[model samples]
Each structure stands twice: as structure tokens, then as C-alpha cells.
Target: MTTSAELLAAYDRQLRTDAETPSALDVEQLGPLRLVTFDGGRGFITYAGLDGADAGTIAGWVAGALGYFRNNPAIRHIEWKSRGHDWAPGLHVALVGNGFEPEESESIMIGRAADLAVDVPLPVGVALRQVTEEEDVRAMSAMADGVFGDPVSTATADSLLRRLSHADGMELWVAECGAEIVSAGRLEPVTGTDFAGIWGGATLQAWRGRGIYRALTAARARSALAMGKTLIHSDSTPYSRPILERSGFVKVSTTTPYIWRAPA
Candidate 1:
């Protein structure tokens, strides 16, 4: 049994780079940051750590990184992912000063896949399965966007389609009642590692507290285990954190994304 500390340390050391950016169009190293350009004009910044740089050095890195994206007209949106356990200094102030807005913080949760592989009962008439068809994928993405209170985005659906075309070991799962998708998430098995990620979990507001999401999670975990993945990890929002905690996941750390959008 791997302890939480050991798992987290491994997560920080091994699973931080291209593992998180399977579909990235390009990846560049900017000092201690990885500047990744994804499709749909989005940019992502992540790194293992700052390597003990001081506040002033970190601020300079922030400015230069933002500037690199700002100068690229195609990069419309940028996300700088910051972790709670990092030794970052003045990062918040620097990001805000560079016009990046902070989004909600989420817990970085990790645990063994077997721990989350327990059977969870679904509501009567609800069925869970993996989805692959374009129509099904678009429907699942729309339901997730609605649950997250974001406008329906064809770009997101298109991105998923592209990922699927690559056969990247990513599986999309949905729980449907009759013809409507009520809950959904994705299982992404990282290559060259023993970990898989459960991401994009969402359940309709009217369908909350019905254990559908848990069932969806368990389905993904089972798929991961079958693929020989031993570790399961997710960046969980408040709504899903308690459920994961009950399923034996530990709060390894916290992550917050600072966003910047280019002027139109």
C-alpha cells in the first residue's frame, strides 16, 4: 500500500508534464514552466516546481511567460496552473498583475484504483456505459457544460473528437436515464505511468445526490484497473470532493488555475 505522501511525491515528480497534455499541439520550456499550446487557441502552463527560485525571480518568469502568450495572437486563452504544496512566492500577485483571473481552487486527490472500484448502485432505469460515437460524445459534452453552468461549446466537443481519433486511451463515460445523459466523466490513462485520471465529472442539478456520479467514477476506475493502472487521481471540485473522500481518496494538494484572455 503506497502512502499518500509517497503517492503525492511521485505525482509531483513524474506525472506533471506531457502526461497532462496528450493533445497539445506544441510544448515549449520557458524557464521552469512548460508553455503548451493546445488546439482552439488555448495555452497551458505547468511545471514540477520552481526549483527554489525567489519571489522576484518567479514574478519575472510570470511576466515573461504571459508576454510570450500575449505576443502570439493565436493564443487567446491561457491557464497557469498553481499547486498549493509548491514553494511559490508572490505568484498570486504576479499573475493578477499580468491580467490573469483566478478560478476556483480544487483538491488534488489520489488513491489506488482498487479502492474506488467498489460497486455503486445506480438509480432505477439508469444505465452506464462508455460512449464513442460522435453524436453520443457531443451529447455528453453538452450535458457536462450545462451542469458546469457554461454555455454549450462545440469547440469542447470537437476537441474530444480529435482526441478520440488519436486513440489516446481516453474513454468517455455517461450515465443516462432513458435517452438523457444525467451524469458524465472521462477516464484518461497516462502513458508510461501507473496512473489514470478521472476528469470532467458533472451531473445535472436536478439529478444531484443520487449516487449517479459515484457510479460513473466507479466505472472509470474499473476501466483503469483493467488497463493495469494502479493509481487514480483527479482535481476535484467541492461537489465531487466529499464523494471521492468517502471512496478513499486523499487530499494530496490543491490546484488553482489563473486564466488570461487575449484582447479581441
Candidate 2:
């Protein structure tokens, strides 16, 4: 029975920093922000907490942060990750003023891995397994993109393949019906932490309510436990938040990503 406050404290102290960006190609510090450059021309902005900055100061940071990324011609898109619990004033105004558009906020769910490692009955003809081959990884990414209603992009697949080369303890799992991937997600085991993150979970619309997602989650939780991880965390969308809540995950906080795209 971990309180939300305790889970959130662990999330901020243990899960933030470079551990949150294991695949980053470059990381630069901008005041209190971590300006991360990743492959596929992506930039990311994240910080553990804003040290009680006023509105005007945050606005200046916003402008300066965007300027830092704008200098890199290779960077075409950026995402600023904001947590609901932070005490930064005028963050919304500052981000929007700098051309960042808000995306949907997700529940920051956290709980013990053992709680989610229980057996979930899978539908017949569907199976879950960890994947590693290049072909399998690409297929899993494409399927997840399609399930999430995004036009499939090779950049996403390419990034995953590159991460695989690092052997970064990232495990890809999928639920397949014969040859088609119906559900998919990835488990990221952070170094020097007691937490494992279940991320990028998505399932086909037709496969909804079939318990496939739960089974897939359970499988990842079991893998986390096997890796000696004590806690499981996910930034869950509305579609998956309920499922996690049903499994005893507490909503410790919320997170929203404000994205900016360079003009083509």
C-alpha cells in the first residue's frame, strides 16, 4: 500500500536525469533543463523540478531552450515533458508562446512489479514473447504506430534498431495472432534504479477488450521482476490507464508533452 506521494517522490528522485534518456545522442544543460538530442532528428526537454521559478523567468527559459535546439539543423522536432506536480508558474503560457503545442496528459501510474506480474488469461491463438531481431522490431514499431493512428514512419523503427545495438536492456514484446501483431509494448530497465518502465503500449482496435493488453502488461511485469526490479511505472493514456488502475497501480501524478516542429 504505497501512497501516491511516496511513489511520486521515488519517480522524481530515481527515474529522472540521464536514466530517462538512455538512448540520447547528446545532452546539454540549459539552466535547470536537460536539452536532449536523440537520433531521428528529435530534441527533448526535461527537468526533475523547477526550483520555484516565477512566470517571467520560466518564459525566458522557454525562449532560450528553443533557441538552443534551433541552432542544430539536424533537429527538426522537440518535446518538452511537464509534470503536473511541478511548481513552475506560467509554464503553459511560456511553452505556447514559444510555438509548443500541448499534447494529451497521461496518468503517471506506479506500483510494485509483483502486483502486476500476476497471470492474465490470454485469448486463444494469441501469444506473447520478447523480441530482438531487426525484422521483428520494425514490425512491432509499425504495428504500434498503426494502432495509435499514426502514419507508419521508418524513423521510429530505425531508432529502435539502433537502441537494440546498444544492448540497453530494452525488451520488446508483442501479442501475435498467427502473423499479425495485435498488441505491442517495450520494457525499459533503467540502470541503477529499482524501477522498470512499461512504455509505448498499443493494441489494435479490433483487439480491444480481449484482455490482450492486460496479458501483455503482465508479461512485461514478470520480466521486470525477473530483472530484479521492484517497481513498475507507466505514463498511461486514457485507454490504458483504467487497465493499470484495475491492477492496483496508483495515479501518482500526470504528465503532458508539449511538442514543437521546425517549419519545413
Candidate 3:
């Protein structure tokens, strides 16, 4: 059994680069930050750590990072990805002062793919399948956004469609109850690494506690194994943390996304 510390170390070393941003349109470096631009006018900020920088230095970095995106007219939204274990000083205050809002934090869960590949029975009248078509992808994205209380956004669906067109080993899985999607998630196999990420896991409120998510996770784990991935990772919300923990995943760390939107 790999400990949480070991798993987190491995995650930082192997899964934090282009593997994490396969769809990035451009990536620029600002000191320790990887300033990435995605297709939907989105900017992302991520870094391994602050390298023992002081609060004043980190504040300067924050201002410079915001300036980098502010100069780009096409960029409307920016997300600064922060880890609980990082050595960032005064980062939260800086982000908040710069008009960034903190979203919910999630547990960074990791475990062997084989440990999560067990057989989980789906609910009666429910079926699971990989979705690709535009309609199905839209339906999946809508269900996911609704479950998370986000307004329906076509940009998300459009991005997923673009990724699907590339056939980049990213699989979208959905558990359907009759004609409606009850649960949905994505399986992203990292190129040049032994890991696969299970992201965007969402289950309809009424469908909770019925093993549909576990079954969906198992299905994805099986798919990851087929792709020759040995490790599985996820930034799991409170709703799905226990389920993954029960399935042999350990909480390696925590992650929070601070979001900033350009002034209208």
C-alpha cells in the first residue's frame, strides 16, 4: 500500500505539466507559474510551489500574473490552482484582493487503478457508456453543470467536442437512467506517464447513494488499465470523497481554484 506522501510526491513529479493541460492553446512562464491559455478565453495559473518566496514577492507575482492576462483582450476568466501543501505565502489574500473568488476545495485522491477496478453493480434500469457525439456530449455537460449548480454553458460542451475530435485518449462516461443522464465523469489518460485522471465526477442528487458513481468509476478504472495506466487520481469533492476512499483511494492533498473574471 503506497502512503499518501509518496503518492503526492509522484503526482507532483509526473502529472503537473502538459499532461495536466493537454488542450492548452499556449503556455507562458512567469517565475514559478505556468500561465496557460485554453481555447475558451480561459487563463489558468499553476505551479509546483513558490520556492520559499516571501509574502511580498508572492504578492508581486500575483500582480504580474494578473497583468499578463489583463493585457489579453480575449481572456475573460482566470483560475489560479493552489494546493493545500504548497509553500505559498499570503496567496489567498493576494488573490482575494485582486478580485478573485475562492471556490470549493477538493481532496486530491490517489490510488492504484487495479484497486478501484472492482465490480460495482449499477442501479436497476441504469446503463453506462462512453459518449462522443455532440448531442450526447452536450447532455453530459449540461447534467454535470446543473449538478454543480453552474449555469448551462455551451463553451464547455464546445471544448469537449474539440478534444473529442482530437481523439486524445480522453473518454467521457455517463450513467444513464432511462433517457436521462444520472451520473457523468471523464477519464483522461496522461501521455508519457503511468497515470490517468478521473475528473468532473457528478451524480444527480436523486441518484446519490445508489452505487452508480462507483460503477462509473470502476468502468473508468478498467478503461485506464486498458490504456496501460497503473495509477488513478482525482480532485474529489466532499460528495464523492467517501466513495473514492471506500474504493481504496487515499487523500494525498487538497486543491482549491481561485477564479477571477475580467471586468465587464
Candidate 4:
């Protein structure tokens, strides 16, 4: 059994390499900031967990990354993801000075995959499985959008379509009540690494407290174990943090996303 620290260490080691990017708009280095391109008209910036930097350097990085995005008309917005454990100086001020606004912060949770594999009770008739078909993938993405309080986005659906084509051991799992998806998440078994990322977990408000999310998490864990992954990590919202803690995941740090929205 891998400890949470060991699990997180493995994740950090792999994320900087194999898990960093998969497309043109993924993760790019512009001086100090890690520039990322998402499916929509958005770009993003994150660091490799830098511990500390002076205010001047931090400010320069923010300005430089913003300049890069401004030069590219393809990017309409950017999000700077900051880790709570990082000791970088003046990050908050720098982001704001350059027009980035802080959004809600989330807990960075990590744990051993086996910890979540314990048998969990599920609502009768609810089942889970990996999705591959285009229509089903689109439906799941739409359900997730609804759960996340975002409007339906064709870009998300299109990206999922492309992701399925590559396969690459990435699998989308959903908890279905009858024919409707009540909860959905993704399993990313990073190649040549001992970690698998459990991402985008969203359960409908009405479905809360029913253990559907845990069951879905377990299903992903079981799959990860089969694929030789020993660890699981997620940047969790407050709503999901307690549930994950009960299931043995520990809060290692917090992450705050700062956004620069293009003028509408």
C-alpha cells in the first residue's frame, strides 16, 4: 500500500513530464509561467509547484504569460492556478495587477488507489462503466456541465470525442440511474507512471449523500489498480472534500484559480 505522500510524489514526478500536455493548447512554458490551452476560447497558467520567488520575478512572470496570450487571438481568457502550499511571493497581487481575478479555491486531495477500493454500497440498479461512443460521451459531458453550473459547451464535447479516439488508457466512467447519468468522472492512467488521476467528479445536487460518487470513485480505483496505478489525485471542491476524506483521501494542499476574462 502506498502512503499518501508517496502517492503524491509519484504524481508530481509524472505530471511534469508525461501528463503535462497532449495538444497545441495544453501546457507551454513562457518564461516562468506554464501556459495552457483548454478546449474553449481559454488559456491558462500554472507553475510546477515553485516554493518561493520574489515579488519582482512573480510579477514579471504574470505579465509575460499575459502578453503571450494577448498576442494570440485564439485565446480569449486565461486562468492562473495557484497552489496553497507554494510560497511564491506576491502571486495574488501580481495576478490582480495584470487583470486576473481569483475564483474559488479548492483542496488538493491525494491518496492511494487501494484505499478507495473497499467495497461500497450502491443504490440498487445503478451501474458504472467506461464510455467510448460519441453520443454517450457528449451526453455525459452535458450532464457534467449541468452539474458544474455551466452552459452546455460543444467544445467540451468535441474534445472528449478526440480524447476517446486516442484512448491512451484514459476512460470516462459514469454512475447511471436507469438511462440517465447521475454522476460522472474520468480516470487517467498515466503511462509509465504509478499514478492515475481521478478528474472532473460531479454528482447532481439531488443525488448528494447517496454514496454514488464514492461508488464511482471506487470503480475508477479498481480500473486504475488493474492498469497498475497505485495512486489517485484530485483537486476537490469543498462539497466533495469531506466525502473523499471519509474514503481515506487526505488534503495535501489547496489550489486557487485566477481568471482573466476577455472583454465581452
Measured against the true structure, the TM-scores of the candidates, in listed sequence, are 0.98, 0.98, 0.98, 0.91
Better-scoring candidate (lDDT), 1 or 3? 3
> What overall lDDT, based on C-alpha atoms, would model 3 receive against the true structure?
0.93
lDDT tens string, model 4, 56-155?
A: 9888888988998888787887888787767788889989999999988998888888889877898888888788898889989999999988999889
Better model by TM-score, 2 or 4?
2
Best first by lDDT, ranked: 3, 2, 1, 4
The digit string of per-residue lDDT tens for model 1 on 1-264 reads: 467789798798669977988888989898889999999899999998999999999999999998888788888999999999999989999999999999999999998899899899888999999999999999999999988889999999999999999999999999999999999999999998889999999999888899999999999999999999999999999999999999788999999999998877
User: The CA-based lDDT of model 4 is what?
Assistant: 0.81
lDDT (Cα) of model 1: 0.93
- List clashing residue pairs in candidate 1: none
Model 2: worst 10 consecutive residues (lDDT sum): 1-10
Name the runs in model 2 displaced over 4 angstroms. none
Clashes of each: 0, 0, 0, 1
Count backbone clashes in candidate 1: 0
In model 3, what is the error at residue 120, expressed in angstroms? 1.0
For model 3, how does the per-residue alpha-carbon lDDT over 208-245 read when each residue is reduced to its tens digit? Answer: 99999999999999999999999999999888889889
Better of 1 and 4 by TM-score: 1
TM-score of 2: 0.98
Computed on alpha carbons, the lDDT of every model, listed in order, comes to 0.93, 0.93, 0.93, 0.81
**Pairwise lDDT winner, candidates 2 and 4:** 2
**Tens-digit per-residue lDDT, 120-177, candidate 2:** 8988999998888989989999998888789998999999999988999999999999
Off by over 4 Å in 4: 1-11, 23-27
For model 2, which pairs clash? none
